[model samples]
Target: MRNKIKKWMRKVCFPISVTVCLLMIGMTVKAQESTSVKKGIFAGDIDLSGMSEAEARQAVTDYVEGLKETEITLLASGDTEVAVTAGDLGITWANPELVSEALEVGTRGNVIERYKVLKDLEHDNLVYPIQISFNLQMISDILLEKCVQYDVQAVDATLTRENGEFQVVEGKTGYTLDVETSIDKVNKFLTEEWDHTACTIALDVDVTEPRGKAEELAQVKDVLGTFTTSYASSGSNRSQNVSNGANLINGTLLYPGDEFSAYESVAPFTKANGYYMAGSYMNGKVVDSLGGGICQVSTTLYNAVLLAELEVTERFNHSMIVTYVDPSADAAIAEGSKDFKFVNNLEYPVYIEGSTSNKHITFTIYGKETRASDREVRYESKVLEVNQPPADIIYPDPGQPIGYIVYDSAHVGYKAQLWKVVLEGGKEVSRTQVNSSSYKMVPRSATVGTATADPAAYEEIMAAIGTGSVDHVKNVIAILTAQAQAPVESPEIGDE
Candidate 1:
């Protein structure tokens, strides 16, 4: 029985073990090969198997850059010529990560599967789809400019008299081409696998009827909510900013679902737009900047929208508290980074009437009344926690006499919650939380004089500091000035 078993093992198990050993060795070689791309891998016309990742990326970028010079001719009037540059068509590389794919040629999947893929690459050349994308909107805009100039819209015959002037005009169907079809054709051409440096394409001729006159203005009725804020303390430039921003938002109509963006409406705050240099907080210090005080207009508008029950989409608090509005009630706006937005929630369209007069900014929201006319809406701020600012920072001033001290403003930090309250006939109905606000405190600053000065003034100033009251430093300066201006003895002239 032992001899029979040994014979069976020699015949079957020996061959199976040898086959398994050779397979393991093959897999080991294939795993090392994964560090580099397989032999038959290529990205477009360029072989990427031996090239490094960075080299492959540069090659792909150069290929796309080469496409930028491709001349695309637009055929017009069936024969006339208009040449379009690749850039004008917004042709640019879309999938830049294709280079990474080439470097990872045989590295994907499990061990055995990866080995199978690497083995297959020895004979088979795998090609991926080359992707080129263009900005559809940019293409549309470019085509629109050309179409408006080269083609005319269809017009129907009409007779009209305006201010005792009568006119009769003949109408004819006009040949027009739309940007939609042009955009589609351009996209298809851009996605073509091979780079055709020079291509010819033509816009199709389509017919359309045109409208005659402008639409009438839609009037808004009913006052939804109104709010007014006083900015009397703000100086001329800042005050003007508030008024300018308010005027920009005036008479603006928003449909039921329209979102109002305060920043978008009142941007480009250049001196040309009547914005003036005013002090604003930047990097923890007050610095002069344009459109410094227009945030007051946005804050007032925000409160008005909230009162009108509009859906608040976005709102932000200032880094520090402002005196115009209470904590958690103010809405702050900075161009591009921060914005205040709200959506009209009423069934009918809403109109904004904003105006500023006598240092006061007001926003009145008018819409179809869904809530009761007597409904009272207001916000109450709830303080959560008080935070202590960091230790005071000291700055040395050589221009001031030694021991002179000047104090900068101190900031207090707090966390507060804003609640929106709804009342009916002076009775509370519903109270909902609007937002939680956190005010960051900027540490108080002191500028200490370090310059050498008269001995009398210096001694008195030092005494004031040692006693814990630097406020007397200025008084010492006053006394020292009086002594210097006193009458001098005649003997001093003889000694000199």
Candidate 2:
């Protein structure tokens, strides 16, 4: 019974093994036969030795028409799919005889030879279309190459203008390519679409300038040409020595707390300053110098500033009183030494306009008219204390003949203190102690000498010895003469 079972097993197992070996041999043979297959599009040749160039090309075109409807697809698993639509796929066959005829007849190749015309006809017009259809993956690769090559190209588009200037804009320039499109590949891929296209690229024209938030603050207000001044004169001069005119206008208007300076605004008189040199007060006498005639302009401007009730920023006095104005009313200015300055105490902008003619000089203050007005100034003087004149004695010497000298000090004068006060609403709002002045009591010295020593010379000697003022000698004489004539009236009252 065991031998019989073993025999049955050998028969079944041996036949089964032999059948499996045969099937394996068949599969290996099939793989070997397909290994040499080169799958791609195919182009055919047409004989057209007798045909013209146009006729040859036309025959190629007619042949390519047959392959237009062909479609090809690629699969991810090394499998392929193909569909041919007779209406769409095209085919073309090259005329080899025409190429051979040209090679034989021509010494040098023509345009046809340069382009490899016959081969190109089959390759570009016929085989290229067939390859793109039958070899779906090759179609995708070729389209990708076209897209990279034609990513940027020149074309035309419309331009529109809106604002200040024109410009140009960049646009997307690219070609479309097919990647994967097959029933078998579509099942395995995330997306399957063969979109092959020749694209048109262009540049967008921008016809406008940017204009949104670009403005300056200076353009909003019109305050360019407003200004002011105080007085007018020729070149810089002291007192009446300055003849007034446009070239001599002095004293600038202050914009609120603005500071003022004589030399800063008024240019110095020189040949470059367009002025004729004039005499200036020096040592109580006139001396010729550039800019010597401009001080009268400063004094006039000072008076106007006082009348306007502006704040005095800086002030100084002249060495001697000017004849054009009283001693108490004069104002002086010297570059880098003394200055006459005033600030606008008023609220609005002030413009100063001044002109001088032959007889008088005038300065006009211009601004927005308001209810505020200038304060009126008045001064009154009274004697505070008086000192008697000193006794004069003449000295005689042989070397220096008979001569006289006078002694005068501030102590030998009438001492007086003055006050300046401001009033508003009929009441004094402020008061200031202005000055403690002393008018000296002059002495008279009579000299009896040789005729060679003139009395004038003796008088000058006395003036030089004392205060160098004739007014002092004249005051003493007047006091003595008045006392001799009217013993009751005092010289102080006469002065008042």
Candidate 3:
């Protein structure tokens, strides 16, 4: 019985001893792992010595968050290898592959002399660089690439001499290019140049497509016929000159987009141009000229050009608007500054027909027939305000002493505001305000003073005031006022 009891005790004692040994081994391993833990060199660990406090904190945060590791293998340098291990000198440890990748991506690196040789060794390698989370850099690069894509629409004025005849690109060839291709290309360039603005492209005028020859020709004919019947006058002095001027303009060539100069194309002031030169109305008076009434010719042409719907490159109003044409409708030519210019917008050549008749001057543009929309142009003049002339000076005639009354006085100059209203199809569309030309009132040069009074001086005084010479008027007033209190006509010999 004693031996059996001892055997059972031994078996239990052996099992307990084995269990205690196992527990001791496990505790030893756990303690070792806790004391020598291996972690990767993260961005947060990078020391920023010179940075401001705020910068230092930001740098640390950005570094740790942005850090990444990659796998890499180094050549064995010596028998005593500085193994990649945690808590070892001249060694960095992380996930093996991650550490290698970090190095390849220009991240953590060995600083000691022992590891210097590893950097020069050439070998097949692969790794990933650490990247920041902000996508601004990536977005900027992509957007820059997109900026090159110019998408815009505009008219291209490419003039290539293809043949002897000069043909506009919009016509003859029908080279209508869309903005998506070429204009957009320019737009892209502009987009890069002007980052803050949108792109806009304008087509050349010819590219806007003027009417075809035949269509424009018909409209010109209609306008000429209407103008001849409506506005021509056969006054005694200007008879036959109007219609003849219109006949001269027919079959006159006007090229597309070309400017037509009236003074140059029409007959010179010489009688050879078929118009007689004589004294004609000029600045509210008569002036002698080779083509004294040529203004009527110019005025008629102005109306016709307006009817054709062509662009006016240059135009001017006469010093005083003509009565034949509405105030705004009259165009005056000043050698270089102003001129009546009309572009031949028709696709085909246009001819002008100008002539003068017993009663009126007429102008017509002839061309190949074309179809055009029916449009009528009309003008209405409205008087906005009338300004009376400055009070006329009732001068005591130099001949008559002071206190003499002259019932009749010459009219002075007056000014007014007028508006030119343009109507299309009976609908008021445009209004242009114009200062009505000031008209000088005719001066009365009556002899009220002594019969011996200087007639020439009196006439000169009247002329000065009529011409609106403010200084002269004031001087005359002063002289008259001083004389007013002096004396009555010397009581001729009859003796008062």
lDDT of each: 0.74, 0.43, 0.44
List the lowest-lDDT window of 10 residues for candidate 3: 82-91
- Candidate 2 Cα errors over 4 Å, as ranges: 1-241, 244-246, 250-253, 283-285, 368-421, 424-430, 433-496
Candidate 1 ranges with C-alpha deviation above 4 Å: 1-145, 149-177, 180-219, 387-393, 399-407, 453-456, 459-496
Output the better candidate (2/3) by lDDT.
Answer: 3
Best by TM-score: 1
Task: List the candidates ranked by TM-score, beginning with the highest.
Answer: 1, 3, 2
lDDT of 3 by residue, 239-327 (tens): 44444445555445565676787666655555666766554544444555655555566667766665555555666556443557545
Comparing candidate 2 with candidate 3, which one achieves the higher TM-score?
3
Candidate 2 lDDT score at position 240: 33
